[model samples]
Target: MNQTIVPDSQARGLLARLPATPRALALLARFDRPIGWWLLFWPGAWAVALAGGGVVRWALIGWLLLGAIAMRGAGCVFNDIVDRDLDAKVARTAARPLASGAMAVKVAWAWLLALCLIGLIVLLQLHLYAQVVALASLALVAAYPFMKRITGWPQIWLGLVFSWAALVGWSEVAGSLTLPGLLLYAGTIFWVVGYDTIYAMQDREDDALIGIGSSALSMGRHVRMGVMLCYLAALGLWGGALWVVRPQILALAALLPIAVHLGWQVITLKEDGIDPLAKFRSNRFAGLLVFCACIVVGNA
Candidate 1:
């Protein structure tokens, strides 16, 4: 009998079309789900672009992008290894390589190691200070998979992990963390919280049944307002970050476009079916809009 892949499979994109063997490995790394890596890469890009990289920082941006994809893939593989049972229980994740027994645990470990090696190569491309800052996230990354089992607001932990690139990116350019860098990190945390909550909405029912916890369940009927607050806080902090970089009144306005995009997500979001996932994925563009804002502020 064929496996039941569930509704979220539409988001699988090209991964769903591959032959079963390689597809499982691709799914394990979430290669088909470019949005995850894009979202992960953006904060770093925003930081670099904000530092006025222009043509000079293009190579650094490329390295950061490679690091994002590799490390994000490694993180997913590690998360799956830890959450295999949980993923099997969740309808949306039931067909994942590890969850469905399509990939062996030993093989997953090898694949994870391979991905981490790529991340290590990218890490070497960073400066000494940036390298240390990047390595500091290892402990946080190791702890993330267990957050959901222990806390109602696991997305908060995820925010810490996902937004870590701000430190790395800024350090790569500035030699250490700065006022703008810290604010950028803090702002990206709120953005992650908002979007991951939206993504969590898809598994609300299954998560509840499986005795799991998430921000979506914690927020309950106040989901829209909760996301709005997260976005608002993100814009406020990010706006401040920009202000510190270049203290122009108009510098603050750079965030307006993405703020509007985030607002659209909140306004159009429905708690049912794919609305949440669609809103979640739309964040890739949201991230880009903010990067553009950073370019304007940092370069101008």
Candidate 2:
């Protein structure tokens, strides 16, 4: 039952082949993990589809995609910089560039600044209203790294931070937020909370030892149930969002597949053998499914 990806020898071989600075920097940014961008991009897409009447906005979408990539990297770098000591103690994150001393803190901060500058450039392409909504997320992003230290619901904070793009996207398309947009944003928050809590489960043991807080620890023996509730709430809110936009039976029908898929995830989830990273990564597909539902309902 060697279910672990990148076995010890393979991991060692991969590390040996990696170049010094650039490769380490890429790893730190998690360029290898496209899931981050996918997660980030979805909220933007959701907003565009809902607000733009399901017509894709290619230019805005492209810019938002780039912004997501850069900002997610910046966020990761900042988190790593702040959590270097804690990352060093965690088996899964011990090899991170900051934690392993492959990159200096000052260098990491400089990299973060560069990425944020790029993100800001992308942000400026949007309307002034969208710009304000986008910039307002900075405080949430700033406070997120410290959340695990203070509350067992750090994933909740992460949901707020990660899904802020929904508001930005809606504002970019509509020039202002609407009730539908707000509902979509709320749904996305619950979605993030559910998936990220699943992700936190992978480091639950280490997190507990080091005094970190996560929904995984809070749920304790009922982690699966907690995830189910979170997922259900997400679905309910998304359905509500769609209802606000279009009250037809077809609009509700569009969500059925997504609901079934989420149910499958809940039923098939192996809480004991759960690989949090994989579970977290799986959310990209979940997001896509819901995005498709939104597009269909909105277009109809």
Candidate 3:
């Protein structure tokens, strides 16, 4: 009896050799973008930490993580599918799987359904109140794609959709909503608006050409100042949330790092640079920094 052991590299190679379309489909789901998952996970984590220090609910965290990945992907895919035609017209989005025709609409829809099913499983794990909070986000999610077509401030809509997890997270842990949770949700919204505006700057030219609306285009030459003000608003709301939760000076102090990070991002941002995408991606770290502040204050 001969037994063979496969090396890790060889196993990976074999897997890589398999048909890659499904893998590509997963990528289109934004599985590759950990930023989305992180953004979704932090709010829930903050709520759990701030809910007076019970045993950290690892199972709930795990479920929320899974839900975030699935739902964020579903949202992105839906956005891409809806904007497939418009995406093809934009330089930055032209190579997207849907826009490039690498994936069929039917196939994308199937993938969307699969992701939504995963989200449903996660939702079922939540308390009834949390479930209701989660379900209420459906309208925001459904309407998000159309905002860029109709309004120059679609970042505001994205804020509402993306930061909704703050509410869900708080409700999950506390079994009810509070002023702190609502303020955190609002703060997260402004943060999303600020960072996403930075993300949108990369496409300002294409957006202008294609007649798509974004804060980037709306602010135009004043983009930097606009982003700065948005960042300030985020900080203010976050500070307010901290005050409501802990009412401590340390909570306010914890915000200093995040404030500096936001300042650095705005001061160093180069809208005309050759690598706006890299700059935009850096906001993942910014989000992480702010989240760290939230966790520190919440856990303290």
Candidate 4:
């Protein structure tokens, strides 16, 4: 019997129309899944918007979008390279180009370099302080693929890696990090932890068998509550970020929409089947809600 490989539902779309090798390479980089970039882009957008640069620094937002796409793709490619063997053991990840042997490791490395080149262009567009802050994340990014092997809370490292854009965006717009930026970064970290934990639920059994750690497995039966707490913490920190900028009681209300949306996720969360994946992907919209709030508060 042949091993049947399964990919996540989001793995289809435009990339499906490409030639075999290129398609495989695109899958390796997760280009078909725009949500990854969207989630990565939002915290940076939140920072830019909250710094009152939503209109004045429109070009910077554009640059952050490009950087997010490139960097997120690069991260996925690097992760696939590192986890190819481990990926083969997970049903949802087993069809990944590297895991399935559809792409060579060397070719994947080249693709990773190509994505980094695009990231480098975006980096050059940032100011010195933001550039240094951004460079510091490379070490974190490099360390992330191994965290699952050593710790159950790998999502914490991912939060640190993914929320880094908040620092870069704040530094670029405000010329340095401050209370608002730090709070935004901290809040975004909890947001990442919440969503990634939902994502991890899909692989719990495989992760257990493979002897890897994940927040989903660690939270166990309390996964929904765990996610709820993470979301609550994210809102609190984000609310603080808004308060630091505007200081009005009404400013704190800016977070209400995202707060409601996150609450909906927890209330509707189901630990089985595709529910976790759906909730995980819903954060893209949640990110937008927060961005809108940032715009309202920052521009007010």
Candidate 5:
């Protein structure tokens, strides 16, 4: 039986040449899939830029980026540990390090701890207020992997998790969350819901067979419309965020490029095959577009 090999597998080329011990650990953390970290990083980037930031803000963004990478790796490892059984049943995930028994549970836990240590180092770069806010997300992050079993919309829970950097970024800069920051967080939650729904497309049939819940399965025939609604709401709230930052009509126009990009994604989305993955990964660019808008509006 052939399993799906997304471009992010670790059992290939140089990665495969690594010692078996490290290779299994790397695969468990999904270190090859930078898209996850990139998606995780963008919200914090957007918030920092939108706060009328300067050089110090750029430095902070660097810290947040590192935190995203480390924490994202940790999250993936934790999720793999939690979902090992389910992953073993899914064709797409059957080869995952933990699911395939390439890595031991105890070792996976140790790797998770190491990555979280990296996150702690990054956290020390932030202020006390930001540190507190960042640490508060632990409960949400801890509960995320189990969400799919109990909720039809686990993507919603993921949105809350992935979009958390917005709050941390805003607090790191401003020392408190404002209306604009809240709006940015809300909008990013919608954006996550949309992109992750596209990602869930690959698992819809398998998920149904296994009785797993997902936004893609929940959307059913209306998956396209569901993604479209999510993107539109994201744009609307982001627009409101920009307006709050600067009450100028031109500030609203800052979202034009991002709007066009999301429109393209929604217009071209397919429920099957690589298109969904392509569209889901395209959010990295979507993030950059939003960051540009935030820079324009916040600095105006």
Candidate 6:
């Protein structure tokens, strides 16, 4: 029988040189996919940039990137553990380490703990207020894996969890969460929903067969419209965030580039094959555009 590789696995080059045990563990944490960490890191960076910490808080951005990498790995490990059975039933996921029995649950839990330890170190680097804000996201993270089983809009719950770094980044720099921070967080939630829906397109048939829910499945033929609305809401909220900080007309224009990029994604989106995956990965670039916008608006 041929080995089925997970379609999105980027485990090659240096990562491919690791031994079987380590490779399986790395894949379990999704270290093979750098895009996940990039997506997870961008929101915090954007918040810090928008809050006017673009220069002075450079070290904080680095620490947040560390935290994002660790925490996102931990989350992926936890999610794979919880979804192992479900994953086994999905063709796209059936090759995952946990689903394929390449890694034991106990070992995955151990790796999860190791990653969380790294996250804890990064969390300690923040001030008391920001630390508290960061801790508050634990509940959201803990509940995320089960969202698919119980709700059609699991992406919304994911939005809440994934976009949480906005609050952390803003509070760490500004010493409190304010309207601008809240708006950035809200906009990031919509962005997460939009892109994650695209990612879910790869699993629609398997997800339906397995009786799980996803935004892609929920929207059906209207998926493009759904993503467009989500992108529009994100741009509007982000514009509000920038305006709250600078309160000038040009501040809003900071969002124009990202708006156009998102528009391009929607305009060219294809619901099948590699198009969805390509568009989903393109958000890494999208995140950079937003970060540049934030820096421009906040520093002006």
* RMSD (CA, Å), each prediction: 1.6, 3.6, 6.4, 1.8, 2.0, 1.3
Q: After superposing candidate 6, which stretches have Cα over 4 Å from the reference?
A: 1-5
Using lDDT as the measure, the top candidate is 6
Q: What would the TM-score be for candidate 6 when compared with the true structure?
A: 0.98
Per-residue accuracy of model 4 over 1-300 as CA lDDT, tens digit each: 122224554655556567788777777777777789999999999999999998899999999999999999999999989999999898888888888888889999999999999999999999999999999999999999999999999999999999999999999999999999999999999999999999999899999999999999999999989999999999999999999999999999888888999999999988886998899889999999999999999898
lDDT of 3 by residue, 97-122 (tens): 78877777999999999999999999
Which residue segments of model 3 deviate by more than 4 Å? 1-18, 53-55, 273-275
Q: Model 2 lDDT vs. the true structure? A: 0.82
Q: Write the per-residue lDDT of candidate 1 for residues 1-300, one digit (tens) a residue.
A: 233344555445566567776777777888777888998899999999888784479999999899999999999999999999999998788888888888889999999999999999999998898999999999999999999999999999999999999889988887889999999999999999999999999889999999888999999999899999999999999998999999998998888899889999999998888689899999999998999999898899
The C-alpha TM-scores of every prediction are 0.96, 0.93, 0.90, 0.97, 0.96, 0.98
Clashing pairs in 6: none
Q: Give stretches of model 2 more than 4 Å off.
A: 1-18, 273-275
Overall lDDT per candidate, in order of appearance: 0.90, 0.82, 0.79, 0.91, 0.89, 0.92
Error of model 3, residue 229, in angstroms: 0.9
Off by over 4 Å in 4: 1-6, 9-13
Summarize candidate 6's per-residue lDDT along 141-179 as a digit string, tens digits: 999999999999999999999999999999998889999
- In candidate 5, which residue ranges exceed 4 Å CA deviation? 1-11
Q: Could you tell which candidate, 3 or 4, scores higher by lDDT?
A: 4
Overall local distance difference test of candidate 3: 0.79
Evaluate model 4: give its lDDT. Answer: 0.91
lDDT of 5 by residue, 107-171 (tens): 88999999999999999998999999999999999999999999999999999999999999988
Point out where model 1 deviates above 4 Å: 1-13
State which candidate, 2 or 5, has the greater lDDT: 5
lDDT of 1 at 169: 90
Q: How far is candidate 5 from the true structure (C-alpha RMSD, Å)?
A: 2.0
Model 2: pairs clashing at backbone N, Cα or C within 3 Å: none
State in Å the error of residue 275, model 6.
0.2
